[model samples]
Target: MRWRSTLVAAAVGAAALLAPVLVAPTASAHGWVTNPPSRQDHCSTGAVSFDCGGLQYEPQSVEAPKGSMQCSGGGGFTVLDDESLPWPRTQIDNSVTMRWQLKAQHATSTWEYFVDGVLHRTFDDHGAKPDAVVEHTVDNLPAGDHTILARWNVADTVNAFYACVDVTVGEGGGTTEPPVDPTDPPVEPGDCDVAAWDPAAVYVLGDRATVGGHTYEARWWTRGENPTTTGEWGAWRDLGAC
Candidate 1:
């Protein structure tokens, strides 16, 4: 596996907030950042509170009435503007998976996602409701430094924007396993090379392949190639030919 080591911010708020706040740094981020667990504003200068995974963010951003944090009792969050937060820019392997949850107030109408300052994907809530969670996954993303920008119609509503990201970087391209392995017994050509084939091209959820005590099912594409087994399902795709 091609391990891409992430350069995490020495401090969480180093890249986004205007000033620095000190907090504990020994624990690993649990998974998801929760917002206002009790609907209270804990952002005070020099004090820290935010959410990630299961633990609240340490050294959280201080609440500012002029910036993104709007209501004191409602909720407040910071946009990920740092380039080092693993934004998955160009040259990134498509096999890598990334996800983030979005929360906004009533004013947001359209949410547009941008990569490297260019518009990539847009979602229209149509004023359906507030605090909607919109998730996206892209596959086989080209390698390079890319920036994903999520811009909402904040000018039209009285809502505050909040987001938390989860990124999984994988090592496969078209092949499932390492193309060459020196430790295994040599098998002759024409041997069933199951890992050599792209799963996205064939297996699909409800579709099954039984071999060697393992039953593989075709789940939706999470990232990289098709026919993956990620539990995080994606928007349904039309199998018909274009």
Candidate 2:
């Protein structure tokens, strides 16, 4: 399946802004913490699921017959399925360790861990719990934003697959905490002059405008010349310049 680069970028931007959640994100300079991977990386295959404190996009139910993995109930929330090593976040030194708490909807399903989308570890989840801790150590992780993802090998309605990661950056470094940025997630993008249906397909052409509970990008459907029907497509009439 193809992933929408635009939406993915938006999600990453959202995650980046979620740094000041106050819970410390189960992270440490050199210690280990656990949580599910971000939702952006799994949007192509996962759905929305509860993680850490808020919510994250999780993997969709694995296709049955066509694939070995399958979700029993409608498929549990998103699970960790990262495609990069030390994903989710980076910039760590030697002495740091990271642990992820994986939760599965089905207790009998086997949960798997991936680094850069590669299988690194596996566990047999026996209990259908919301928070299950999986530990891993980080020798060195590239500094910058990382895409960490996790999912279940077998999907069952009764089971859920999740990963809550805990990252410890430095062992003894007193001031080696990862840089923190506190911001709020952007409200949903809005339309220009009209309210268009199925924004997933097309957005009006115009500059962005935000107001009330919506954010609209003023987009023009026509080029330089004005068309007989003079109005904006994706532009919002309520919100001004965005």
Candidate 3:
């Protein structure tokens, strides 16, 4: 009876030791920029319909050691470093609001924003956990085509999440279609031999619609999203003036 009691006690002790290991949480996926979509955001959202490899599925997994200058964070997603790829550059004013979507609300040290390889703006978190969604307003961005590299530095870990947004700031950068003049008569439906975009109508990939005297093709399925309001990486791709 004494031996049986000893065996039972030993088994319970072992189970206690293994409990924490069995229930240990795995590392969660991190974060990425969405609005004025980052390269990975473009890949994951089907805004860029190219072969972005595994990055297309795991946009929030571009984690690497701190202090990387490359857009991929010197990680495995090298497709983001390709300059020749037709990355859509979002048109914006000199001041823009950047938005980030987080999968794992990490305790952050600092949020750094860089433009054209120069540090532009930064937000200090003081080693605090961030919310699922973060927004920062960056001002006085250089007026031209530029790449904005955003870094999310983790407070507890040596790793950081990276995102790169290509943008055409202010005027005279990329060949964007000129804005429709306010004095021009409002274009009627069927004016361009294409149906005017209807917010109530569902649009899928390859669907064409006319709006604001210009034609647009849907890059992916969308509804209730106006074509003119959607930026370069949005669901609609501008097909120029009618």
Candidate 4:
């Protein structure tokens, strides 16, 4: 089997915009927090993660109790909510960007973000289906130890997907990376999967496939489009070094 890029999946890029959820995610749906690698990611890949119950096998599908928003998805996945266990934290500063890998896009209600239990920002996308790729930013965060909770609430269904990113907000805002303006020149590839860039293949948000021996991740839905083409709405992201 050919290996695809992982960055577009988990532990890849960072996009921040989630909020309090009124419902839980459905069982059929799939997705995960790719950037800054969620707890499930660390367990699934044997990386710098701690205490992730059975989430290693299914990082994208952490089911919470119906109609309830929870950080620790119900069942064995409760390891995500284990406060005593050290979940690897991402180093970040004010005004952060986050990337999400949503395998099954639904009619979304709204995406939200919480900084240390306080609502900071929200991205309203109700009645609209998201692209193959999704991203957002949380601006003006207080610099300190913060638990960032990002939630994607589905509109039609009583469900939501949850991703918790632990971060240390720093003092220098400029040091933090700016959100991806797909229109701006593509930023240099960080630690991404290696593969060739394919323009003819159809892709969805968070989908990963290898081309030319290098892996390129889809930023959104596209066909017959090159990943290297720079634009705010560009469709592909290069994952460095196979």
Highest TM-score scorer: 3
- Sort every candidate by TM-score, greatest first: 3, 4, 1, 2
Model 1, span 1-242: residue lDDT tens? 22332335434445546443334354321111222111111221212233322113432221222233122212333323222332221234544333323322344355544444444444444444434443444443333433333334444545323332222223443222223334433322222333332322334443333333333433443222222223222222222111
Cα lDDT for residue 157, model 1? 40
RMSD of each: 20.9, 25.0, 13.7, 20.1
lDDT at position 179, candidate 1: 37
Candidate 3, which segments miss by more than 4 Å at Cα? Answer: 1-26, 172-242
Better of 1 and 2 by TM-score: 1
How close is every model to the real structure, measured as TM-score? 0.31, 0.26, 0.61, 0.57
lDDT of 3 by residue, 179-234 (tens): 44354333333338889998667688778899989988876566656788767645
Local error of candidate 2 at 198, Å?
Answer: 53
Count of backbone collisions within predicted model 1 = 28
Put down candidate 2 lDDT per residue, 1-242, tens digits, no spaces: 14688888889888888856754654211101233333332232233333311222222222122122321112233233322323334335532333443333233344454444444334444333324454433323333333333444333443333333323334532223433223322344344444433322323444443334444443332111122122232122224322
Q: In angstroms, give how far residue 221 of model 1 lies from its true place.
A: 13
